[model samples]
Target: MSFAALGLVPPPTFCKKRGIEGFRSHLSLCGVVVGDLVSTSVPRPPGPVPSMTPASRRGLISWAELDFRAYVFGAIRNERNEFTDAFIKQLRLRPDKFVVVSRSETDAGQWLELFGGDQDETFYQMRSRMFEAPMASFNNRPVGHGAWDNIRMGRDVLYSTGQAGEMDITGYLRKLETERNEGWLFWLKKDRFKVKYLLILDAQPNRSGIQLIQDVAWAAMCAAGYVRGAYSIQKYVKATDALLQAKITERLSWLPPSYALTFPVSNHHNALLKARYARYQA
Candidate 1:
């Protein structure tokens, strides 16, 4: 559906005020017209509000903002290589589902500089932004200070992994990936699932632009992965585990039969039964 069909088209004066002539021109090239709107404000039909948990709300906010950033800046390219609009498409998300409140060039440029740069630079910057003071704290120290310092000081054991000692960052990440690819049922049974650690790992460059945007989004959703009030660790774990399952399921579906046999349906059922029995036993 078109923006006009959804009553999202802005009036000429509104577009002029926002200096969106360039965006309009770009949309025109895509065969989308924004000239039919007469009202200054877009009309919306009222509907019942959907229920959402705090973590879900935060995740949605993060996803929407990052999706908007990707949509706006996806066409830009530097001297090294040409960037493509591969984010939303990769995730199979509809572009119209996102509602961006601001489309200022300054905001887009700032986000691009923060996330679209070198991987190492992006990693540390995200660390400071998401895990350091002003964004998060526990007893006046950064919530992730212990883990961050351990990684920085080359300590083999990290706080995030609990009893999983003497493991480097690479090993820890590999373990997380293994659990994720095994599926959400496997992840639920693991004791080392920590939202803070997952956020830290999310900050690291692992995939494409989607990873960078998700890093920014997850940080924004719950800084340092700390939650209060009604938001619990279980809720955070479930939310993040859903994202992990989505990331891995795409590849799982295309695996060869030999590889597919590794994740048999019976194993999944057994895992579910074990989890339920464990919960009852507790």
Candidate 2:
């Protein structure tokens, strides 16, 4: 069955139980308690809409995290109108899972407590609760600004590998690459590693943001905690429909690398991984 058939929309229970008051209340409490610990930038942009540099249609998703520190931009749509089916079919989706995290730069201790409480739906519910208002605010802010559907807050710095300081996973370390590089050209090349990502929901503004998306997606697929399903691609009306796939693919080609973290991964991620590693190409 298709993901849509499975009712992939947000659970209605979340809507009924967590009212505006509840989300805002928690935001207030978290904001107040963590205010001294963390800081958010003003909600508006710095100036008028400057001319956008035509970024290569590639290099959107990061293999590692969601922050997208190396590249900075907002995607307007996921499907492009100009591309044809034959031209688009040559590309394969990248294979990689993003790491999702929910850390407060200000309250590391509490953030740890929230995410460390066993790997389960509670983790997502907690994060969804934490990010709900901010997410609503961020998503809605786009409406007022224009017909567009996005907004920018403060920009995040791409910290050096060593700069991640304590959160460093040593094995994943490249230790020296401090500034996040323009990843698309490097990642989407004919012969380089390929992985899509999902960012964390907090909008860490790092590649980890993509990782966060992937992490949460995996969590969602858990029919039961005991049944940790792998990522999978299905014959959806979208993917299977050539015209639709081409339109959607061309447009979303610019999605932040972490955007892939939200894709219908499963077997596809495994294949992409195998292909990139040269073990048994997907």
Candidate 3:
């Protein structure tokens, strides 16, 4: 039903404004559009809001503003030759743009200190800016459980940035491919609309030398091995087991599968294996 038909009028405070335009600007600041105000009786609930366009937000962090230490930490990993090469070139091109945060300085305080605070504030309210997500602290345990431990910690650290509208496309994509197929829906059912910025965390330490390098060279070798065609099932089982061990598939429903920020491309396989599988299907 129309709000006018329901016997409602603009609030007296709204009428107090100079004109409709002033009231509309105030409504927009409160997450409401002037047109929406007329069509709907209910008001939008108050909460955090997006303040920038996708392009403008993305522009804020050029390669130069990226943390250098984490880049080095990630670049040394297997299969990361491309990233390492790119980062090294950027570092040489503009060393002044780099932000250095050491291992001991990974805490919330260090981040605030390095990034600075607001005009009237003495500190960068890290907690105030933190984005809360469900999977942030999913599998908490001591750090001795190998790759799983690393993933758990990584998820937790990344969750803290959700308030900034960081979207994890890779995680969301994986959910569509794997988990949702098995009835694990409703992962990002609520916050999907609120997501504005992509979540691309700097490489963390738990994954430095663990992932195998599977570039074109490795794909060629695998293809040659698969041509022999013996024990193909056994090899497939082993690969599956390794993937399970890595605990590297997208577990977070909020993430999409496009970005490879924290983990290697989980769906990659050697060319030989692909050919053998296709032939077996035939």
Candidate 4:
């Protein structure tokens, strides 16, 4: 199913214009950047507009925690669109399992509490429990310093090996438990819980953001039953007149059929003037 099937559509303001080019033009006014050659073959589903609801209240059931950072960069480098397809397909198949999160949710404190370690458990203890959990019930447990340090050290050594490589080091580390590796043993207790999926949203479209997403994805994958799809939506901002420049410089390898929002940037002086004028009117 397409986004249209999920009740997404261009706003009514843009609906008055005909065809894809018109849609793109309208999107620019809102600061959304769409690839010039977007495919329009996908059909929009017909229905009355639904009432708006807060994302946090959506009550979507996620099996795993998705790292938005990784999902966006992965999509950028996804020349073949495979990554995009994997993401969208999951949404179509299990829309109820995904919830959109904002950039604020990426805060270290919140992430640590949710996925890493908080007051309740150490990072190693959390990892050990998650590894032991079953697929259907996997979720982030507490993370503490010792467990995280052990995993990080193993990852560093694997990367340093060059031959063993850093790629898929999380998966490799999971394998270490089978080998009874001294360092990993502490966090490899027999447990049955595991994480199923992670859905992250509003991640910044930058290198650091990409690393964050990758790190989250890797952490989830390290557990057993690593599912194929983790979806994310990255937010991009641009000045009103810089649409063309953005289109040229920021080439998305696979432009998935999705809604875009364009927030026009204004000079600081102009913004201040407008704010003052609004206050004066009030």
**lDDT scores in order:** 0.27, 0.24, 0.26, 0.26
lDDT per residue for candidate 1 within 115-233, as digits (tens), equals 22233332221111112123222233322222222222111111124343433233233344464546422243244422212111222221232333332232222422232223333
The positional error of residue 26 in candidate 3, measured at the CA in angstroms, is 38
Give stretches of model 3 more than 4 Å off.
1-84, 88-126, 129-154, 157-177, 181-282
Better of 2 and 3 by lDDT: 3
Candidate 2 on 1-282: residue-level lDDT in tens? 122111233322312322221221111211111001111222343222222343234532111111121111111112223321211121111112211222222343322312222233121211110011111232233111222212221111112132364234321113112234235212222223221211122323223223332333233223112122354333111122332233235445677756633445223333333344464223
| lDDT, candidate 2, at 185 | 18
Return the TM-score for each candidate structure: 0.18, 0.18, 0.15, 0.16
Whose lDDT is higher: candidate 3's or candidate 4's?
4
Model 4: how far is 30 from its true place, Å? Answer: 21
For model 2, the superposed segments whose C-alpha errors exceed 4 Å read 1-200, 226-268, 276-282
- Report how far off residue 262 is in candidate 1 (Å): 4.7
What is the RMSD, in Å, between candidate 1 and the native fold over all Cα? Answer: 24.0
Give the Å shift of residue 184 in candidate 2: 29
lDDT of 3 by residue, 1-282 (tens): 112111133432322322332222222222222221111112332222332223224323111001111111111111234433443333233223222221111233322212211233221111112122222121331122111111122232222333334332232323334543354322322333321111122222212111111111112223323222233534643443343223234232244645322433222223335555778778
Looking at model 4, residue 1 earns an lDDT score of: 9
By TM-score, the better pick of 1 and 3 is: 1
lDDT of 2 at 138: 25
